[model samples]
Target: MRAVTVRPGAKDSVEVGEVPDPVPADGDLLVDALAVGVCGTDKEIARGEYGTAPPGGERLVLGHESLGRVRQAPPGSGFSAGDLVAGVVRRPDPEPCGACARGEFDMCRNGRYTERGIKELDGYGSEAWRVEAEYAVKLEPHLDRVGVLMEPTTVVAKAWEQVERVGARSWFEPQRVLVTGAGPIGLLATLLGIQRGLEVHVLDRVTEGPKPGLVRDLGATYHAKDIEQVISAVCPDIVIEATGANEPVLASLTGTAPYGVVCLTGVSPSGRRATVDAGAVNREIVLQNDAVVGSVNANLRHYRQAADALAEADPAWLERVITRRVPLERAAEAFREQPDDVKVVIEF
Candidate 1:
């Protein structure tokens, strides 16, 4: 089998080459790779920003967002060969650790990567892969090719879960919400906010087209050209920062309404941190009771919900989100086209 690997400790580590095919163990399912989505995290890994590959492994496969078909499944494993599936990247061990006992395995100190073509675990961006049968979930037969993106969409779904950790209200309730930075995460938060009936507003310094159009199409108000001008005109009740830049984070805090909640959804660039008016946040906390929170990679249930939403999204609208489609061989090119890139899927 051919797989993408990051040569450990190499200056520019990424290389696609022939590797041993995955062999299934008892109660494991073997899958044939179909599609995988490259994420910002993958780019970071390639740049040696996220940390080296797991111990005792060379050229760690670099993919987490994936979709594929089952090629083999152990008897009575509850999945059959030929079943199409899309699953979350995290695989939790069933040991009775204190965190696992409380259903907080995502926070489990013992949790480790046990999936295909990932940083620690080999991921699904390959000719074939295998994993514990229980880790794979079957997909609906009618779902289209975009279903491969279930993994990234799961991040939004998981954020929704964390958003629920606080409290969520319909945007239609006349509650104004501001999404900072018009990147993929920001756009996703905007779309989810609009779907939930909020009067959504977005802020970003970049003067661009499709992103603003995409937000408006999804029923949110887009604001860029002048961020402060837009903020002054629209007082938002909730703020989501997804720019991965410090300025947006500070601006999001500045524009939030009294007693509103702010969700930090962006992955900060390496060695970067937001500098905010601490006095302002302090004043807001005392005067308006505002809140700030953060979210990360999703759990198993979020994977299912994200898939459902992606599978149900309007075909035309979803098609627009897909900026480009590149083959496994062009993975490097996909990374180079960052800056204004949206969804880039790597087909196996």
Candidate 2:
């Protein structure tokens, strides 16, 4: 079987080649890969800026945003042979932290958590893969084509969950939300915002693209202007900052309504220095009781939440989010950036 493999820290080393077929362990489900979504993390790993292979191995399977069909399931596992599923990414460290002990490995405190495709595990980028039954979340049958999006959706689901948890600290009833980025994470954040009955506004740099229309079609406003201008005018009660760029992240720090909750989901590159008015940013947050929290990776609960959200979403809209699909043989093409691309997936 062929799988996407990459040598960590070796730039441009990602390639697809024959690998031994997966062998499931006890309580593991053998799945036939259907597709895998390529995102910034995957690109970063491909560029050698991030990622790690299984211990003592040089090549790592390069996928975490996975979608597949179960080919074999253990008896009494509550999963069938044909179920559509997406495997959970993060696994608890062997020396379980308090969080991991409670099934909250996403919040692992010791920084020793292993993640499929990103850490010390072989991911689901192969022709076939095996996952523990408890770590797989079954998807709605109708999501066959768009279920590759489940992982990214889980990200935003966790972000929103973080925002609400932070908001619960006080009298919080947010009416509007500002999502800073029109990429998959941002758009999906917008979708979840709309589902919550909040007015959603998305800001992205591209003035001409499907992004603007995608936002508007979801009954949200789209802005391509300056981040400050959009944030000031919107005065959103909650800001979901999905752009790791300096400007929008800085603006979100001080540009929300009183008692606002800002959830930062994007990962910015280190060593990119930027000037910031630290005093003012601190003063704004302190005076208004604002909260800023960074969220990434999803746990089992979030995966279930994402599954339900995707099931309720419009199939056509979800299909549009996947702007490009490359076959496994041409998997390298999926890494090349396209000007108007949203979410690119490699079909198995």
- Full-model lDDT for every candidate: 0.70, 0.96
Q: After superposition, how far is residue 241 of candidate 2 from its true place, in Å?
A: 0.3
Highest-scoring model, TM-score: 2
In model 2, what are the clashing residue pairs, if there are any? none
Q: Report lDDT (Cα) of residue 221, candidate 1.
A: 79
**Candidate 2's error at 113, in angstroms?**
1.0
284-325 per-residue lDDT for model 1 (tens digits)? 667866667787777667777776776666657766777777
Question: All candidates' TM-scores?
Answer: 0.88, 0.99
On lDDT, the candidate that comes out on top is 2
Residue-level lDDT of model 2, residues 1-348, one tens digit each, is 999999999999989998999988999999999999999999999999999899999999989999999999999999999999999999999999999999999999999999999999988999999999999999999999999999999999999999999999877899999999999999999999999999999999998979999999999999999998999999999999998989999999999999999999989988989998899999999999999999999999999999999999999999999999999999999999999999999999
